[model samples]
Target: MDLLEKKIYIAGHKGMVGSAIWRHLQARGADNLIGSYSNDLDLRDQQSVSDFFERERPDIVINAAAKVGGILANDSFPFEFLMDNLRIQNNLINSSLDQNVERFLFLGSSCVYPKKADQPIKEEYLLTGPLEETNESYAIAKIAGIRACEAIFKNKKKMYTSIMPSNLYGAFDNFDLNSSHVLPAMIRKFHDSKINGNQPVKLWGTGSPLREFLYVDDLADAAIFILDKNSHHPLINVGTGHDIEINKLAKMVQSVVGHEGEIFWDTNKPDGTHRKVMDISKITGMGWEPKVSLIQGITQTYKWYLQNINSLKMVNMYI
Candidate 1:
């Protein structure tokens, strides 16, 4: 079905990727894009989620929200990462299917690939080996979401597609050094170090792991591409098909942020996976390619960080 002006509900519309999708749809003249904050909709509750699906009855759905955090948060809250993500995804997928949504898209992560998968991983590399222990719980839940979408696509020939995006960062990213992803974490570290008299920044691991990163807006563009194309892939990898080492990433962030401070790596921390590149040929074959290069994306993100230094920082709420 043509998705122009379709009632589309993006579950995690406030996030980096979801927000980008929302803006993209706005520019595309889709005036009916709808989203609700988790506080209002509590997607983790099955009955509530099912009721919302029935009530909204959106023509299209994009599952982009999850309990995303860094290695420290994941290691500390494995149960929350696993159970919350499971509940949120299961409720959304089940309710959307029940409501007979015309097209559904589930956003997965590259961490679903095996920890030791081949460089430039492919869609077929999922579950090929052990997952990285740091984010295994979150990764497993995402894997379940992908499997659910695949099952629906297989059984009903539905337009249920799952996209595994590489590590994403952008304007609305979490920059909390303790709980944010690597890119945002590095940004915060460099920013703080620069602001506080250019103190040397201490980073985790040996900075040897090779990783892939995609800009969140580019990911949103790909989501729109898939939605507009009425895509039917069980799983497709979305990335720039490139990779960089952690040390190199740090240097790039430092350069972009104008931080002249030295970077000190604490090798005591685990480097996690050695490499996690994506074989984005599947999505490329589908005519969607990432437009933003890493350097360009990082510079844009740093500009955003400079613009919203006070707001983008995540503050943990205590009860």
Candidate 2:
């Protein structure tokens, strides 16, 4: 089926991931793309999602909506992190199955993998061991979502697939320090410190943990590529197959933000995971590659953060 002619519903269209997908679909001449703000459609509510599906009758559904945050936010609100995500994905997946959607794509994070897995985590390593304590609840919810899609693909022979992306950052990313991921949070901290006369910036953790990040738009492209492919794999990892230490990442973000401040590491804070870099052979072998490098993506995200700082501040207040 041609993707352009189909009605595509992107849940959480305003988020970093969903917005990127929405723009890409629009650029590809997908006029029937559909979305709703949380105010208009509470994805956590099952009946509302069902009603929206019945009314729109979309041919395709992209489940990009979820309750997401950083280590501090996840630790503080474990219940919301788990239950809200469970409710949101459950409603959308159930509605898509009921509507008999032609294609369904579930977006999950690399956090679904185990904490102490191999250096380069593989899809087969999921559930092999324990998860990071900081975001265990969020990871479990995502695991459930992935398993749900896998079950549908196996039993019902439906095109229900899940893409597990590495840490993502780009335009429309959550920049609130309390809840934003490590990258965007670093970006905000450095920029704010630079603006404040290069004051010393205090960062959490000992800056020893390693992480792999992907540009949200690159993940969007991968999503579209995987959606159009003829693969039978229900789960695939999307990443750059590269890892960077937190200290190096901090220095890079400081340079990008042009911050001349001294960075102070708080050793008391917990490092969520020692290292996490996904094995991207599955997607790259399928002819999908990430176009944005870490430095390039960071520079672009800093530019966006600068341009939208005021609005982001306003949005952070309520988030």
Candidate 3:
């Protein structure tokens, strides 16, 4: 398809994952990249999305926009998380289909898998059982997006596919405690505590849940790899294929941030899911694998956070 010559539109180009993909594409010599901010174009508005696609006529569409957060944010704003995500992806997918976009890529999370799915969750485990209650609404919306791509690929024979990534963290990550994911949240908390006289760092849940994290850039690389190959897999899992307990992750973040404070666990809080890891054999077999180790990724992420701490402090106001 000569992806470098195609006009590509990344829906959430400013976000951590999307920005990484955009940079990766640019580095790969994709000159005709396109993107717009929410103010310029509301993805939830079908007419607006239709207009943008009709006007831009991008050859490839990457759906990376979504209302995402941690357990607290998701639990508090379930409706927005569900409806906003559904609207954004629905508009993008349908509009691309109507506009006859050459290729489409939908980014999803590991949360799409069942809460009680077998260990080392595989692509087939989706919808096998109930989802973790904390983020079920968001998961449902993502599941719908994946199925939408699957249907189009199955019937219309288009190159629409979904990539489910596990716990991504990197540059441009949301460090706002209220809405950020576990990894970024931990980084922020430990950093703040370290600077504030090493105060005790209180963390939610029992620090027992296990999670797998992939650097956002790795996900971006995977996306580019798929686009270059024009792979037709309906859905593929992108992750490190390994996991660590929350307690161990906390210790690592604490060390990275140089926080010597006592770690306190809030037992009253929910752990969300006991374990959520992806089986990356599918993507690995396709010649794509994560290059960043957790320690290296976290070290780089912490460095970014330090450089952007002043601006990040204002993030809570928006949330």
Positional deviation of 130 in candidate 1, in angstroms? Answer: 1.5
Poorest 10 consecutive residues by lDDT, candidate 2: 310-319
* Clashing residue pairs, backbone N/CA/C < 3 A, model 2: none
The C-alpha TM-scores of every prediction are: 0.97, 0.98, 0.98
- For all candidates, the clash counts are 0, 0, 0
Which candidate, 1 or 3, would have the higher lDDT against the true structure? 3
lDDT of 2 by residue, 10-73 (tens): 9999889999999998998989999999998999999999999999999999999999999999
Model 3 stretches with alpha carbons more than 4 Å out = 317-319
**Candidate 1, poorest ten consecutive residues by summed lDDT:** 310-319
Q: Give candidate 2 regions above 4 Å deviation.
A: 317-319
The global Cα lDDT (0 to 1) of model 2 is 0.93
- Candidate 2 — number of clashing residue pairs? 0
lDDT of 1 by residue, 1-319 (tens): 6687699999999988899999988998898888988888898888889889888999999998899998988999999999999999999889988999988899999999998898889899888899999999999999999998999999988889898999999988988766788998898889889998899999999999898999988998998988888565789888999999999999999999889988999998878889899999988998889999999999999999889876554363311
Give the per-residue lDDT of model 3 (tens digit) for 32-61: 999989999999999999999999999999
Q: Which candidate model has the greater lDDT, 1 or 2?
A: 2
Runs of candidate 1 with Cα error greater than 4 angstroms are: 313-319
